[model samples]
Target: MSADAQTAGSRRSSETGFAARTGGGYSGPMPDITIVYEHPAWFLPLFTGLEARGISFDAVHADGLVFDPADTRPPAPVVFNRIAMSSFLRAPEHPIFFAQALMAQWQAVGARVVNGADVLAIDANKARQLALIAGLGLAIPATRVVHRAADLVAAAATLRFPVVVKANIGGSGAGIVRYDSADELAAAVADGNAPDSIDRVLMVQEYVPVRSGAITRIETLGGKYLYAIDVDGGGGFDLCPADVCLTAPGKAAVSVVQAHPAPELIAAAERIAVAAGMDVGGVEVMIDDRDGTPRFYDVNALSNFVADPVTVIGFDPHDRLIDWLADRIVESKA
Candidate 1:
């Protein structure tokens, strides 16, 4: 480990978001964990972390991934899910649903799936996330849900102007577009310019001017608060904070920094995680610039921690995550 990552080992307790230590490697016939994922680049850091700890893991790329019902034995004792909802953006034939089935198959036979199928169902749908958050008596953006782009115009009538039409199954900011006027939205629907989700569900939401031009993303693990990062996109909607995204050609830069959330904010995030069945994920709440109301809009099952951990956030969250994974390996064997 470099000095930056090594610095993380010294800081214990709350700053690291986990209490366990990286109990080290696994030497078993089957690997300790199997990560089911679709994206090619996102899990590089995680793979590196797992390997650094001398842990055993298997990476199953979900694209064109298949399995049979006859198979009873699991490849690993613990399965970690890494499938992304925005997978459809990279390829038309995405594995978002296939991943759910695969993990369900694993879980049925007693494999401990981190961020399993139940959690993926919530991660894959925005409408479901909003309802789940609202059911907890939490605030969310004023929005309308519909199954077709044509209905978006009608839905717009119920919401304020300058609203955004978001695909219910979206990620990395795909399938989201903002319209300033009702006519603009109507024209978009008329010209077939409005966005459609993989699941064909759409949400016309109040374009809450992001307070302070940024939105805060709170990460949780094991239904506990891990850490939060405020992501600022400088007026861009594709505000994904993963470092690899920053290097994409022609993409505007985003600012990512650690945020020490209040007790209420942390509690609310934790509640949403538990409700969503998210073993490891993030909950996003943007303070409505209009009235300073914190509108909880998104709950993500995949948390690619912010870039440059040591300098930006004082420690590498990945270290603690590895610690948790190591513990899981120990648990599965016991």
Candidate 2:
């Protein structure tokens, strides 16, 4: 193991003493709530939320996290997972696999993991996202999954024109390309110009044009609706709700007005969260221009509420999120 991994292992081992002292119960002081995550900027609001409540917590950077399978219990009782699926886009070295393993480890030991391992697994796979969407009886654009570049042509034949080829493991719109014609897709495949797949898997999906040139994203906390916002659909794909992402050139800024998704759409988003085993996250849906039906497209296990939500959505979701966390902490102790 690397030095960082060794240090993390050592730290967990030492914390066994605290576990022993508490007799595996939440009797004494509350255990620290460890935030396992990547991307410092995305977590600033979350950090602020915890600090505002004077909650005892620690940030464990997932980039260097290490967990021993032999260790039967997590050092911390409450773990909030904030590992982004898009980490690979920012850094050559990503800890997605390591983070997944660590989440499983935490769950095995009965740690109160918010947005636990199952959600992480679903969030990392777009095919799984589609399956969950379809399972929830929600509308989804027609899509086909392919494992080889040679299969792209055949897959595109099954979808409508102006299809998008997306990497199954895509995050923040990293590996997505729109092809207006089969000839265009074939040309890209022939020239090795196709978007490289992170997991050697791709999805050719029909492009669903938005009805209002905007896509609605609903944020949920502890499996309930917190707020919703609409982002300009004309904006290119890297639609991370963080203020930094919105500043990119050609990226449409988030609307300052609160967006109330249809009541049915809100219910569907909540069901999607429950189906994916996510406690906190966002669900993205757009009204199809052709049918006027809301089609659920993306399920974000790690939700970064749009920047300055109070101004846009009439309330600060992070404060509400922290309230949920505080309740979980108290419940864990009880």
Candidate 3:
């Protein structure tokens, strides 16, 4: 790792798992856990894992902005994390920044935060994450991060028409649009860049034609590969039921095959997670039909698997992920 990366890693590591000491070193303690989640249903696996392990954790809604460390509610020696804050869920408006501040303050007071602020900030920026992924020698589609429609149009021309225009902060197919003709691409970019719209810049890329079947979702827990899910999707951009998607590769120009990606792709995910400080995170990749290279498109630091684990990976990821987190907690203490 470069000196800058190493320095950033060290700082992030300390922030995520260490407790400050009066004598200037660090101390360890039992991990009092606080879960930040909005949907109880989606977090069933986490809750199940915690319960199965006999660990008691306080659950906090992600929408809250005020947190008092002094309250008898949650004690120290805790891991404060809300895995649900990923783009899978829409970020609450107005208080989002303040909510993050409160969480950081709680951590400052004593709690160890898994997937801490540094990690979250880095993972949230799609362009930065993609650049890092590409830097790690992963194959990524030709991409252009642009603030204006003209730049996007130019990039499209360079990338050769029918590019994918996506919001820089988008996820789970949100804010994703495909434009076949130059006019269509230009119109989409104009809408995205309009003042009344989000006004957020976009990341445009040459849409890789993926084989139909499934897209691979690889999760890394503490720099270790956990599991991959083949996300079978509709032949087109829309989402279809997993069963339907897995039946056969659709005839769409770009089909979705959500399966265990190539070994190279898994390695790419590992590198990304380690660099992004995601002890536990997921990376999404699509097999490019043009050259048959698995090109990375998304990195999610906070992720939960709701798909059928037994059919997808031949085992339950909940058990594996929780076990890894449990062991990492002990290892961190050590």
Q: What CA RMSD would you report for each candidate?
A: 8.6, 5.4, 9.9
- Model 3 per-residue lDDT tens digits across residues 1-334: 0111111112311212321111111113323465655443456567667767876554444442244444332233455455443224344352333435555665576556677766766655778888888888888889988776568777777786667787665544556777788788777557754221143667778877776545677878878788776665544553322332234254233333336566777777888888887767788787877777788877777666535667646777778777765665565456
Candidate 2: residue pairs that collide: none
Return the TM-score for each candidate structure. Answer: 0.90, 0.89, 0.75
Tens-digit lDDT track of model 1 for 144-247: 99998888888889888899999999987888899999999999899998998888889999899987898999999888988898999998887778776777
Each model's lDDT: 0.81, 0.77, 0.59
Highest-TM-score candidate? 1
Question: Candidate 1: lDDT over CA atoms?
Answer: 0.81
Best by lDDT: 1
Cα lDDT tens digits, model 2, 1-334, are 1223333221322322211121111223435686776775677777767767788776565544556677775657688888888888877778776678778888788778998888888999889999989987888989998899889999889778999999888787789999999999999999999987667888899998888778888988777898888877454676677776767576654553468877898899999988888899999998999989888989998888887777787778888888888888887767
In terms of TM-score, which candidate is stronger, 1 or 3? 1
Sorted on TM-score, best first, the list reads 1, 2, 3
Q: What does the lDDT read for residue 190 in candidate 2?
A: 98
